[model samples]
Target: MAAAARLAVAGHRVAVYERSRTHGGGVGRLAREGFAFDTGPGLLHLPAVHRDLFVKTGKRPLEQCVEMTQVDPAVRHVFADGTDVALPNASRAGVVAALDAAAGPGAGERWSDLVNRGREVWDATRRPLLEEPLREDGVERLRRDPYPGAARRGLFRRAAPRTLEAVAARELKDPRLVALLESHALAYGLDPRVAPASATVLPYMEQTFGSWYVRGGLRALAYALYERCLERRVEFFFGAEAVGVVEKDGRAAGLRLADGDTAGADLVVAGVSPGRLAALAPGATGPSAVPVPPGRVSVLLALSGARPEGTVHRTVVHGDRLAELDAVFGTGAPGTGSYRPTVTVLRPDDPTTRPDDAHEAVTLTATVAPHGRVDWADDGVAAEFAERMVRAAAAAVPGLPERVLWREVRTPAHTEAETGAEGGGVPAPVLAGAGGAYLRPANTTRMPGLYLVGGFSHPGGGLAHAGMSGALVAGLVVEGADFRGSQ
Candidate 1:
């Protein structure tokens, strides 16, 4: 929708062919009996991305489109040892003080120091890896780790951490602190054991930019973007599934629809997974070689009690790191052993989420193996996992199991059914280093006039990265091959 709005404003006749009857592919909402819940991401990490889209595409700004507010005490962490700490939103000093109060004196400083180094990673890659299109030499350039402060081994020598887990162990030193660092990677479906040290930017981005929530849920932002697209004269063709990219004289000329109809076009932008893209444009290579990341298991609870005042909006109930990583990456058994998997509990204070003050809506999410790796369709399997999530969330929400009026469980199978992502795998954000294993496919494909957008393309997944993907595609389309990116 961001690309559509931009292209429309650029005097191009843009038509979006959607398989579903909705605009947002993965961003969806579920409302039942006057209780509403956002089925996808509950918070917006980087609002500047959407703000930039609105500024470029329309006269009305993002603030005028949706009600967005920064979440204070950004996230409360309930560690495995029962230690709780609430990190303030975008306040380094406040976070330091809070962590000191919760853990000890040096805990805050160690965390702050790591994040400070993460700023170096962010500064080095923010433009090349994000704003600009992935250049041909991008992979080689980004393969080297940019994180500063490697521990000194011998005289005039340093041992640089290669992975996020290594960075946490070498720097943070505390078990709870390690969980805090690794949880950020787990939330994005990345295994900290293997994820690049540059992945530290994940938590850095969140802490620096602060967490935000849109009133009525993040689905509201999707609606706002859809409306922006419509206002820009971008036409929408719902239920028109594009099965193939029509090639004429070695260039993308149109799309072959599912209904045996063809829609002619001068250019084609496919926002789909690499697996699906291979089927659409045969013989064309995708952008990256990274394996499909794991998906999420969400349990939406419609509770009978009201949201208590002063309750934190988001909480992270940390679980056994080794068990979770092994289960999610398929290194071990599918079921979480005696240890509980990490679960995120969200209880928004918005009145629109409930019928009245007497009731509250809560959501629990945990990263798990994709559909191909696990049978999420089995009612018993999904039920068991949901039960575990509820149990883990009890640390954050008091009497969680008892308060539930009813619960709805969504797994990778549901994601595959809804979004058509191969195996219902959620894409992780593009990161530097680790042999370019974390890089996503370039926006421009080998096929001429055929471009890729959304989570599967350059900049990878997440709300902000996907939006940036749209912007990059738009720049490539409007400014042509030589386009460097936004200034």
Candidate 2:
């Protein structure tokens, strides 16, 4: 939608063909009996991406489209050892103080120093990895990790940590602190043990920009973008599934729809996954070495009681780190019975989410094996894992079992049915290390007039990165091949 709106404003006739009736692909909402819950991401990080989109494409800003506010005390962490700490939103001093109070002396300083190093990583790759189109030399340039190593004490020099896990153990030291650092990677389906140390930019981005929430839910933001696209005269055709890309004279000329109809276009921009793109346009080059990422399991809880005052919007209930990582990433047993998996509990204090002050809505999410790895469609399998997730969530929400009026469980099977991603895999953001294993395919493909957009392409996943992907595609389309990025 962002790309469509920008193209329309730039004097292009834009038409969006959507397989589903809705606009937002994954940013969906679940509402039952007057209670609502966000089925995708609970909070927005780095909202500036959307703000920039609104500013460039339309007259109204993002604030006018959706009521957005920073979530103070951004996230509360319930560590494995029962130690709890609430980190204030976007405040370095406040986070340092809170960590010191919760994890003993020097703990906060160590974390602060790590984030300071993360800032360096952020600066080094912000342009090449994000704002700009993926350059031809992108892979080679980003293969070298930019995270500076911790200082050596003696004369002998030590090599920098190559992975996030090594960085946490070497710098943070504390088990709770280690969990805190690794959780950021886990949230995006990245295993800390193998994820590049440059992944520290995840926490740095969240802590620096602060977490945000839109009024009603993130679905509102999607609706706003859809509306913005409509205002730009961008036409939408729902229920139109593109089965293949029509090639004419060695260039993409149109799309072959499922209903035996074709929509010819001067330029074609596909927002589907790499696998789907390959199916659409045969012989198209895909990412060289991107792994199939894990999927998310969400449990939506509708409670009978009102949201308690002073309750944090987001809470991370840390579980057994080894067990959680092994179950999700390692070649271990399928079930989560051996250890409690880490779960994130979300309780938004918005009246729109409930019938009235007498009711509350909560969402629980955890990263897990994708559909192929685990049979998410089996009722028994999904229910058992959901039960464990709820049990893990009990550590954060008081009287959670008793407060539930009803619950709904959604697994990767549901995601596969909703979106056509293979095995319901969720893509991770593009990172600058691990020999460019995490980089996504470039926006421009080998076929002329054919472009790629959305989470599966350049810049990769996350609300912010996906939005940036659209911008990059738009720039490439509007300015031709020489376009670099926004100034």
Candidate 3:
């Protein structure tokens, strides 16, 4: 939708061909039994990406299209040891105080310092890495660690932390703090043990800009973008899956759809997984396929009660991390293993989600190995995981077991059928460490006139990152290779 709107605004005749009947692929809405739930992303951060797109492409801003509400006390963390802390949104002082009160004396100070350093990292990478087209240099500049850690001097050596885990262990000095840091990475399908120290920027970005929610649900944001495209006269064809890019003289000349119809085009922007893109545009090479990480296991509940006043919108009920991390980040193959899981419970304060004030809608999400690893396609496996997740989420919603009217289980298999992500994987946002281990496919392809957008492209996944990818792709298409980025 971002690319279509931008191109249309640029006075280029634009038409979007989507395989699915709906616009938003993963960012979809589910309405069943009088309950409405956002089937994809539960939280939205870095909304400015879409805000800028709206400001540039149309007279109306994003807020005019979809109402957004800031989520205060952004997240409630329920630790394994039974300690709970609700961290306030965009409040450094509050977060520090909360950490000190929950973890120990000076724990908040350590977190404050980490955020300060994260600010530096964000400042350094925000433009070149995100707002701009990926440098042709393959971002070798980021290969060198940029995390600010305590430096040690020796007779002939200097040492500093390089990974998120190392930074947590060295600086935070609290198991809860370490778990907190690791959870940030884990939530995104990234392993803190391998994620760069700069990954700390995740928390800083959320806290600094603040987490937000569309008044209805995240699906509302997707609908807003789609509506913006329609306003810009971007034509869209549903169920017209492109079989391949029509090539003429080594450039993308048009698209060949599955129905034996051809749509000639000046350019082609593919918002698809790397594997699908390769199949659609043969001979184009992307970054070597990274094993698809685990996808989300969500349990949607319709409870016969009202949302408690002043309840935190989101909660993280930490599980046995020691037993879970290995299973989550280990091999992607199926196996029998004892698994402990971290569960996130979401209760949005919106009447639109439920039948009435007397009823409430709740969602529970957990990161587990992708479908291939545990056969999420199997009803038995999915049901068992859903039950486990619901039990854990009971910590977030008191008497949750008793309050349930009915429940719905959404597994990775559902994601696969909807979005064509291999193994129903949920892509993670691009990180700045591990020697480009997290870099995604560049917008420009060897196949001239063909560009990549969406989660599979440069700047990586997440709603905000995918929107940024569109901005980068649009800039490259409109302004040419010399285009640095959106100013």
Error of 3 at 307 (Å): 1.0
Report the Cα RMSD per candidate.
1.5, 1.2, 1.9
The residue ranges of model 2 lying beyond 4 angstroms of the native Cα positions read 154-157, 335-337
lDDT scores for all predictions? 0.91, 0.90, 0.86
TM-score per model over all chains:
0.98, 0.98, 0.97
Clashing pairs in 2: none
Model 1, TM vs. native:
0.98
Candidate 3 similarity to native, TM-score? 0.97
lDDT, residue 411, candidate 2: 93
Q: Tens-digit lDDT track for model 1 on 1-487?
A: 8889888999999999998878899999999998999989999988999999999998999999999999997999999999999999999999989999999999999899899888989999999888999986877899887877655656663566899999999999999999999999999999999899999998899999999999999999999999999999899999888899999999999999999999999999999988889889976664446576899999999999889889999999998878778889989986545559899999999999999999999999999999877888888989998999999999999998899999999999999888889778999889999888888888898889999899888899999998999999999999998899875
Alpha-carbon runs more than 4 Å astray in model 1: 151-157, 286-288, 335-338
lDDT of 2 by residue, 295-316 (tens): 9999999998878899999999
Q: Which pairs of residues collide in candidate 1?
A: 287-441
